[model samples]
Target: MTAMSTVPWLTILGLIPLVGALFVAFVPGSAETAKRMALGFSLVTLVIGIIAATQFDVSSSAQFQLGEQHSWIPQFGVSYALGVDGIALVLILMALVLTPICLLAAWHDVPEEVGPRGGQRAKTYFALLLVLETFMVGVFAATDVFLFYVFFEAMLIPVYFLIGRFGGARRQYAAMKFLLFSLAGGLVMLVAVIALYLQGPGGTDGFLIERLTGLSIDPTTERLLFVGFFLAFAVKAPMVPFHTWLPDAATESTPATATLLVGVLDKVGTFGMIRFCLQLFPEASQWATPVVVVLAVISVIYGALLAIGQTDMMRLISYTSVSHFGFIVLGIFAFTSVGQGGSTLYMVNHGFSTAALFLFAAMLVRRHNSNSKRIGDYGGWQRVTPALAGIFLVAGLSGLALPGLSSFVSEFLVLVGSFSTQPVATVIATSGIILAALYILLMFNRVMTGPKPEELVAEGVTVDEGWRKSSGGTTVRDLTTRDKLVAAPLIAAFVVLGFLPNIALNFINPAVDKTLSYVQQAIPSLNPAGTAAEGSSK
Candidate 1:
């Protein structure tokens, strides 16, 4: 809105990493140089993200801040538009912060391998990571519907290779399944996108979200289009029936890949539900709430239960994400400011918690030389790695939403908001909190506190021979300087957000207010006094 917008903050924030990826790809130096270059670029982007966040005027009446729009394709109504509300801003910031941390976490992930053509494996890995960062930032920032879909589809390319190329043995199968599910959802969305454009004003900037915000359509048509978009998000949110691809993808991908997959990218689903499904089709959103709420509750309970039964640590963490995402979706459809705001905050909180768990778990597995993912393979680690154990415990506690942690606040807000409308479903979803405690503590007890694997095998227990042999004697190394570096920011985030949720909520609540006003859904608890006054007048 101002000449200051000439800076194109969001575009540069996304482009810096994109350009870094290209540079890394062509670097003639060793793998170490590529890694450092990638990390430095990620940090610079983070600095830009923080600057943009500071530039935002929370007091402004505008729904989006730091706006930047330029026409891209005139005839098709597509434009190089970018903007962010409070929700998108926090998500972008989360992605930015996590990128550098993930780089640090993955510093040694790739071993320099020689190819006949002389391509560096590490270069490819780091470049893919930076490319993924660009798409992640753009996906959250795009205000043009067409631009959003472009970033959404483009995201799949780097992720598929990241998993299929550098991940575990079954990586190809997992990658293909993830691609298939995502592509199927994307195709449905493509239909909806085209239908939406056809129904719009059909001009140079017709696909701008602001332009399409309140377009009138017949009930049947609106409902049909809403279904197309919602189906895509549900698969991405990965609510129950469509969520089959996640466990496979998470289990097979490297920790860094899984961190971004569940933490940042998956959020695009719930974000789309808010940005498009509810914003563009308010009536349909209200019409579909009952079913969506039911599906959300199902995701909550089902994911937790599956997590409890998992043997592999990565798969367990993945299922826990499925459960956490359910809570987020539940809050969004609840339609109260408190619920929607909580959902947004939960997205940020869960990203940090899940990333910590996955990265830390991988580090422990690698250090112990167990080369196994079975929870049964790890035992009595409290003595061997006390500092790492303690840090991992904090991450676990955050996952379960223990009181005084950041996640507890968001989870609490979500439940309170949902209870005011869909009390029964909210109550049923509350069981997930109980199940969360079971999985986290039980997993800690089994994987961190019990007898060693060799001792268990000595007592006539069945265990993997490799894990038993690899479980070294007492006094294994603890968290390293780099490990501490990777964790410090995340841990500090938990502490800050735990005690001062308003740091995020202040930015979030204003945008939530605007969204609720735009959607015009009837949420009973949102204004009980006003509703009473209206009834008296009637």
Candidate 2:
């Protein structure tokens, strides 16, 4: 069989989870069955993602790969176009990898109905998760701007429900806030998308990314259009002022939902900044860089300070992400291939590391009877749940950029690369690292290291009657076999990516080079090659 005859793997990859969502919704089955079906389908998607990655030509030109395009709306110049570069491919793979783990992590997370029949809840929950998965894959793979916007807007629907329906107390408030914030961003982007459409040469070719990139717009128009797109991305990126919605959403949602929100959905914001803002409005990007860099630095320091102040564990983690995302944005705006490539790799690493932290924290909350998320409610947990505490430490250390963790590699590259272009910002941003250590270690100490509360011990003792009969009358238990299974992949990812980040950077660097070339073309003096020249002369 010719290579062309091979399965349309990218299309299949997007479809499997979507089709699985339908099956979960319609099939007559128990909650257990729905959970299994969702996991199975997600795993299939993960396998397909692997196959697609293997098929990718990393050494090829820095253009969209494995493309599949078909005319969708001839009148609107829109088409069903999908493709991936190294950057998109890695993010897509991260999404696929995380979905199954999320399924497994949430296997017993959904509460059963107290009254008559709790028939519909599991079906609805699993179905929405699968649907979200489909959109996640589609968003990363979409090549056409209109197609990306469609996926971008559609993904929010499932997430809204995932938070509103399956979240903690104040779920409604958090869900509404999340919805409103996202809708506002989407609406702003829609206007920009329309503006872009109107400006293009009207035809079926108008909305194609390649076509849009070649447009010659006036400077004022370019900057205005850039603002439209950048505003949406900044909100989604939840930079500083726009970031207020994330803490509440994370605090209220289930760990799995929060994981996907921060890990996958938030990546879209930074991804758009790179793919759209930088690529389409190169001069405008450079024009906006001074202000954007300042915002990024504020996000870094401000987020870290806020994280240190958070009483709730989930909110604390969410704030830390704000801080981490700042580093990613800084690397992106630094305008060096090394910086861009580092930012791309940071996206992947942050997803896995954040997933581990959120999911593990969920397990701890579960052990604590699901009510108390306050750090004060959990002290000396390490004494009772050493395994869980150890895992939490590993995850937290990754967040703090410990040596030999995935985050360290990415964070290091971001600083080193950005320093070449923006030294003052990079130096200021470095202080966030110290703040990171303080927050992570302080949280660990408060929640895991202090004396065990007598009330906590009493509760654990009351719940585990069998513990008195077994060893030493220890009340609290460690992570179960299933919990270990869910955590293993995330832990492995941290280690693997930490040591062999080249596996991702090798693919990412080519795209970074191409994007930098565009930016250099726009502002010749800002060229990274100039830095190389300076180094050679020295």
Candidate 3:
């Protein structure tokens, strides 16, 4: 174990945004000042994250590296432990990469309809964003189960305000829905954590995840505990029936908030399943495999169908996340190394592609204030806003798992690996690939091709006009230099990861293998080294 005092960098990294949050909260008021402070603070955290990423020893034998641990509550056996295996490390990096971009993208998105409190409103908004960043980072870095839970619950405050204060017409309703759902999930999991703590050896406090993993529980007890955790995790994963809040929340919040919520924050749910569920409750996971896979396939197909039916751009993209998350869940329960690895890879790729897509949608909506989210309202946009259109095209194609993109690799690996274990579910999920293509192509055709709508015509939503000329009147301006700066990195990430995924896969594969290793003792058929990849119809 690494000394807590020697190199507590991950703790410092987590604190950077937290300190920034406190600073922004008291910094008087001014939109310009708020923006600068927010960007500056988030950048500091990003630097910390980058250093953490670079310092990580990929070739090391340890599953989790650069650890920092200190006893917090000796009686409870809880500690302030923080570390990242390959999986959590990548997510921390992703959150870092996206945070600043979201701040920059929201620069002009928040209107002055906020009244005299507008200045304070902007400052509060930025403060919440900063706080959210800290929790997001903390959740990924936490090595202790209790620490993970703290970060998990702490994240809701900023997001609640982000939606309630800064979102669309029904922001209040959306915010409450999000709050209730999250609170319910948390309450259920709290009980399970208590049970795990009580089951500690000699009742000596065993809240440490690594220690808890070694304890054996009866199959019935395991299933009960698993359900407690899985219900909370599944709702957060927003798998199938529990996913209703997502589309509404995404559509109402600003694009930047939506990007973080859908792209990085949502990944925590899937991450938890990977880290806690499959790792801690192996036998119960095996017993529940058939049911979980069925739900996963339903999420994939149901989300795709919902996405195809949505007219709102943000809502449409939100449904796509629901669908993508389904694939991740499916891969995890498939109980193969390939499936786990693919699920991890899916997290990274989806973060990039979905961030790009949401940002693009934000750009489009900003230009045309008309709530016309319908397909017919956005014909021939490629003619005037080619850069924006092009980015959207890349995002949309990636969303559908286009070949040579980051998603294609993960989705392919997931389906192939899952076939041997859950062949029927795998086959059904493959059809989702085709369905993804359908929805994405339809989205592209509706917004990019055909005759430009009269509203867009008036808004100067032309494909050929660059931002420099301002051809679409004052209302429909082209992509600003800031917009390019924000989106370029995300787009580049998608392309780069698509071709050289080993940069990420190398990190994910080991962590995924560790997770599978923990589970295979109870589920013997899940050995990854010998699994065949042929798609089975049985």
Per-prediction TM-score to the true structure, in the order listed: 0.93, 0.94, 0.93
lDDT of 3 at 371: 45
Ranking by TM-score: 2, 1, 3
lDDT tens digits, residue span 264-358, model 2? 89999999999899988999999999999999999999999999999999999999999999999999999987778888999999999899989
Candidate achieving the largest TM-score: 2
lDDT of 1 by residue, 207-308 (tens): 888888888888899999999999999888888978999999999998899999999999999999999998898888888999999999999999999999
Off by over 4 Å in 2: 1-6, 114-117, 455-474, 530-538
lDDT of 3 by residue, 1-538 (tens): 2223257778887788878877777867677787898899889888877886788876676667778777788777778888888999888888998999999888876655466666666777877888888889889888777778888888888899899989999999998999888889988988887886766563233566777784679788888888888988887888988888898888889888999998998998999998888888888888888889989999999999998998877888899988999999999998887887888889889998899888887787666545445666677777767778888898889889898988998898888778878898999889899889988889888888876544443333444222222344433556777878888898788788889888888888767777777887667766655643321210
Off by over 4 Å in 3: 1-5, 113-118, 202-205, 454-475, 528-538
Listed per model in order, the count of residue pairs whose N, CA or C atoms clash below 3 Å is 0, 0, 10
Which ten-residue region of model 2 has the weakest summed lDDT? 464-473
TM-score winner between 1 and 2, please give it.
2
RMSD of 1: 4.8
Colliding pairs, model 3: 382-463, 383-462, 383-463, 383-464, 384-462, 384-463, 384-464, 385-462, 385-463, 460-472
Local error of candidate 3 at 363, Å?
0.5
Taken over the whole model, the C-alpha lDDT of each candidate is: 0.87, 0.86, 0.81
Q: After superposition, how far is residue 505 of candidate 2 from its true place, in Å?
A: 0.9
Error of 3 at 336 (Å): 1.3
